[model samples]
Target chain A: MKTIFFTGKGGVGKSTLSAAAAWQLAESGKRVLAISFDPAHNLGDIFGRTLGHKVTRFSANLDLRETDLDEAAAEYIRRNTSILTEVYSYTKAFNLDRYFKVLRHSPGVEEYAALTALEDLLRTSDDYDVVVIDTPPTGLTLRILALPRISITWVDRLRRIRRDILDKRHTVHSITGTFSEEGQKLAYEEKDDRVMQKLTELFDRYVAVARHLESDANRVAVVFNPDYLSLRESQRILDGLSDLNLGVNVAFNNKYTQGLSEIADSMERELFDGRDAPPPVHRIPWEPYRREKSYEISYDLTQLFAL
Target chain B: MSEHQPNFLIRLWRSLRAFLRGIDQAQRERVVALTAYEARELENMFVLMLLGSFAGMPSPPSFLAVELLPHLEHEIRVLNRRAESSTDALAEIMGTIDADA
Candidate 1:
């Protein structure tokens, strides 16, 4: 399945643009799942429905979800804590439960949770032809985008450390003819080491996430208004994605007006500099009167995102 | 002569063999302890890398570290003990020497 991410500064019409894109894709008879990862969720509001963490069917071909980032973070910690408890039942004496309770409030947990949620959606989205993500503001969205690659480096070092520890244990075991101490059986080989196995599993997961983010199946689009702050933030978003060796597939100049054409052209020049073939820039004209339904405005923008 | 007693040369030979075996066993135990200590030191380094953020050092992300917590029972136990006895200077010195050895 192809994955598309819509990100920009707050109140830059990301939810509207991504919602429109999803509606357009679904209208074209393609199965689509549009998810909102913003903590301040408005995708459901735009759709005129109350959506939650659960997937809701907005139409015959479209599914909608607004991820609860707080709940996602909590669930991520709880799931890993349960796994730790299950594997090391004897660690109760160390008060790991209390320690994990503190982990819920730890830094970067939200970003990690967001990454995992995206990973899950991507992994299980085979039934859908396209998945569009409405992400949080620039900072959090950039961190989430960069997480997979950053995490892969740490996981790689951890795997090496685990291997060294296993090698030392093997040496000790060979000399002592014993691998158990204080009723705990230590693994001296890579295959038998649970820590090594966990590290390898995490390494593979990080690698998969990194590959998915950098692959052709993924597309990123930046949504912004033709204003100074929005243009600057959009440039930052472009630079951030470039730092991660990823490119934007499109740019949505939302609320475009004739007066702001000069500013918009400058933004395009700055954001797409040094590129031989820059992605197309689609401008959504300003509406004189607000429409009762989002589809009314989205109808024209559909062809811009045609598959 | 007592019925339990052996001849003088046989008794001397048996005593000598027993003495050598005692020294050999002691050397074997020392080697075992040293290897075990080295292995433990390596394990400590591994745990430190994972949990270094708590020590004001850069470390792996907590989500990843927490997943390996199950297999870190021994390291955690050692950390708890170290924390409890951290103020003991003599013990710390002895530990340093033991680690160095």
Candidate 2:
């Protein structure tokens, strides 16, 4: 799928830009899914409807969803716990609630939750010609963008360890009678062992996501206000994406008004610092009166289509 | 004793069966011992990965660890024993007797 991610500092007009792009893509008869990972979602307000965690049809050929992180997190935990409970019923004595509490505070919970949601979309996105993601502000956006690569490595190591353990267990089990207690427990059938199976599934899922994001079909557009702070944040985002080998094309200078163009010219110059200027800068016109009608407001954002 | 004596063929067949059964029993015992040895090593390795956090090695994500915790109770017990013992850590896990310890 052709994926375009819109991100910037708070109030950089990313959601608006993403909505516009989704609308334009749909108008051109391409199936489009525009999703908001921003906690403070304005996509719903733009579409003038409350979007839940599920995909909501915005118009013909267009769909939108604002991911509810808490809902997503709970669902992620519930799904994992159920699978774990089934595979390792013996964990019942370990005060699982305490461990789950630890998971709640785990450093990368939000990132993993977001990644889980993204992987779900990618797996099912064959129906869409393009998927446009409206991400959270600078810091969280960068973290979420980097999540797949980090997670893949983490899971890969776990898989190797699990495989070795299983291999040993298999050798032991074949020698022991299958009816023996330890033999039964050590049964390491790759097809039957759900714990190992889960690891393998996660490993494959993470790898697929990492590869997809790194592929040329995926592009990131950093939305920034013409202000120095937004520009600086965009630079960090650019560097972060480059580190992941993700493509960043077209920085959108949004909410243009009152000689902001002049500010953008100097800011862009300072930001790029003689490196090949990051993607061409696209100037979006200021439309205060039509602010409520974000879809219409963003229709003029056709420059993104060229990207 | 002469009245109870079996045919020569039948007596020979019974003697061969008993001898083969003895050999099968010995082979089965050896296989079971070898398997038990390998199984212990695998079980220890699995425990190390899942509960590595307890040993100060970074574990898989806490959520994953939590999920695997139930299946790892036995491993955890073994780990606890190993931790409490003054025995060499490597020897304890590999199921080899430490002569010095």
Candidate 3:
């Protein structure tokens, strides 16, 4: 009942859909928040207001947060900075802090932080009755989306390594398994467990994120242009989400009018019917008004609500 | 100064010992096993070391971080630009609840 997500290739109006959804929910007298967790901060520019990392209310009931992924990633690192010093002689071989700074810019760092933001919002915040996520483009969004399973797989491998280390250490100390590695094994186990726990926790956490978005209790809508290719791509994404066990309750936004608007195509009429071979594609047709700003969607919200 | 270095095996063993000690109890077995995977998890191991090193300081554990962060920042600036393909219009997304609402 509390979550939704709008993601597609960038420039497909994900931010716009998120804003409209927040506006609609707020207008309905529900507490709502729209989040743009993309590394890009276009949501602020789209909403015509800059937002801090935390919730900053844009209207009476709608709050907007455009999490700066770098800052969020730093904060995530800060949370566990304590354990880093106690266990490893990190300062000896290299400047550990400097190393992390470099690692943060590595290929997938932004997605890592962006997923962390979603984790923070879902776990920490209770300020909204509905939450809408404006994700990055398709490729990056998939990286973020697939992170849970990816991290889980990493943990499984880490666990195997821990077991092997135990086995080898035990073999080395056959005479005194209890006396020899007992101390060192326990210490190493605790630290390795901590890492595994961190990663596994995220796996469960992403499930909650996906489940909340998929729930029929809340609403989820896919926003795409009225083109055959766009609809096909959206369906592919929908299939991917389904593979992850997430549901798309309703597909909306990208409203068009009669007689050749910029994006409207004849295939939209058939796609809206959702009666092709696959069957059971949730198709909500386009509404009349399409505006640049989220606030402008309130008038259209009433009409949408009726539909 | 001696041109000859310590025996490769001795040096490798010492580093292995140090790396093992840096890891946690439960992770030790994995670390040892993944010692073979040094080529693969080296970056990850290094990250683990850094986070462990900078455990509880106000600033980064090393001054080198300041230099590294700026270099990374410069790279990100360059990358973010090349990454931006088209000036896509930013749009708003929101919704009314299901009739269940």
Candidate 4:
């Protein structure tokens, strides 16, 4: 199975390409899932159908879904909040609820939820041969990408801290019934594991899913529009994604062209199709029907999506 | 946790710290999209994934049942409710593509 993670700065037509690719793949007898992890979901518009949380039938073998992070973070929080009960009270003592209200706005929190969704989808959704993800805007998308590594480091540190704190005991057995130093150690030990436990889960999922992308066979594609700044941003992201050791395939969606005909020609020759030059580019050119954002229901999108 | 790498707990602690620093302009700003300046964070994410490293593995992730479905249900509910309020169902259907993102 291959995972095509189409991520870049938002509004560069990531969903448009992912939906079209899944449509194309499904038409060719491969089971396909066009999943959107963007906070602002837009696949419904491109595919002429609403993409809900659960996989909805878009075609004979194609399904669509948009991941929700708010609920993911809440679930992760529900299990891990116990470890932070002491600190929760401490935070409340300092009026941290005001901040919790605001931390909801953090880029990291949303990305965590998105990554959790990605991990689950990649692992559990075995029905599909291909899972095409339409990612969020660049900044948050990058955060989600780095989350696996940062999370692993965090969990490792937590385990080490727990071990260090446990190793510093002066006396194992205590005389007091309720006030024993041993009792305190036991309490902290459990609390520490509680914290480390979730961290470990997060780290594991991130690493496994990330490695799957590193393979050339997985064919992780970076989708982009033909704008200069967006193309530049895509190059930078390509360099960054390369650093992540994830196998990447590049697609320049020459979707819209008002005045840059020659540039598109050059891009197709040198970057996308490479008819005359290099061959890394797997160009999914823009279809004439997709020029208008508003779409009519097509009986068969396979013909519609033909490059 | 130790004074080392940032995890959910550490980020939470930092969140609290930011909260305490004041409910001012700085606190209001949480995410600065590194996508614009540099790709350090993005590279880091892939590096971790590439390593196939992790300690805790839950039997199955809690995300599938809880977050993904519930959020979709909510969105659908909201959208349906909005649709019901409209007298011209045809117009709503025609215009919803542009209305809801």
Task: Please report the candidate that would top lDDT against the real structure.
Answer: 1
Clashes of 3: 29
The better candidate by DockQ, 1 or 4, is: 1
The 10-residue segment of model 1 chain A with minimum total lDDT is A298-307
- B1-101: candidate 1 lDDT, tens digit per residue: 66646687788999999999998877776666666666666677778778899899888777777777767888777666656775884665565456535
Clashes of each: 0, 1, 29, 2
lDDT of each: 0.81, 0.73, 0.54, 0.54
Model 4 per-residue lDDT tens digits across residues B1-101: 55555577788998898888765533222211111111222222222222222323331222221222221222233334444654775554434333433
TM-scores for chain A, candidates in order?
0.91, 0.88, 0.72, 0.73
TM-score of each model, paired residue for residue: 0.85, 0.81, 0.59, 0.58
C-alpha positional error of residue A231 in candidate 2 after TM-score superposition, expressed in Å: 1.6
Residues A170-222, candidate 3: write the lDDT tens digits.
44344233413113333224344343355355447766765554455444456
Tell me the alpha-carbon RMSD of every candidate: 4.3, 4.5, 18.8, 22.9
Q: Can you tell me which runs of candidate 4 are displaced by over 4 Å?
A: A9-11, A69-102, A169-192, A256-262, A265-279, A283-285, A290-307, B1-101
State residue A221's C-alpha deviation in candidate 2, in Å. 0.6
Rank ordering of all candidates by TM-score, starting from the highest: 1, 2, 3, 4
The positional error of residue B38 in candidate 1, measured at the CA in angstroms, is: 2.0
For model 1, the superposed segments whose C-alpha errors exceed 4 Å read: A80-99, A275-277, A288-291, A298-307, B1-31, B80-101
* Candidate 3: Cα lDDT at B41: 32
Q: Give the TM-score of candidate 4.
A: 0.58
DockQ per candidate: 0.49, 0.31, 0.02, 0.01
Better of 2 and 3 by DockQ: 2
Q: Which residue pairs does candidate 2 place in steric collision?
A: A91-B70
Query: Candidate 3's residue-wise lDDT over B31-99, tens digit each?
Result: 433332232133233333323334453322232232123212222332344236214312100111111
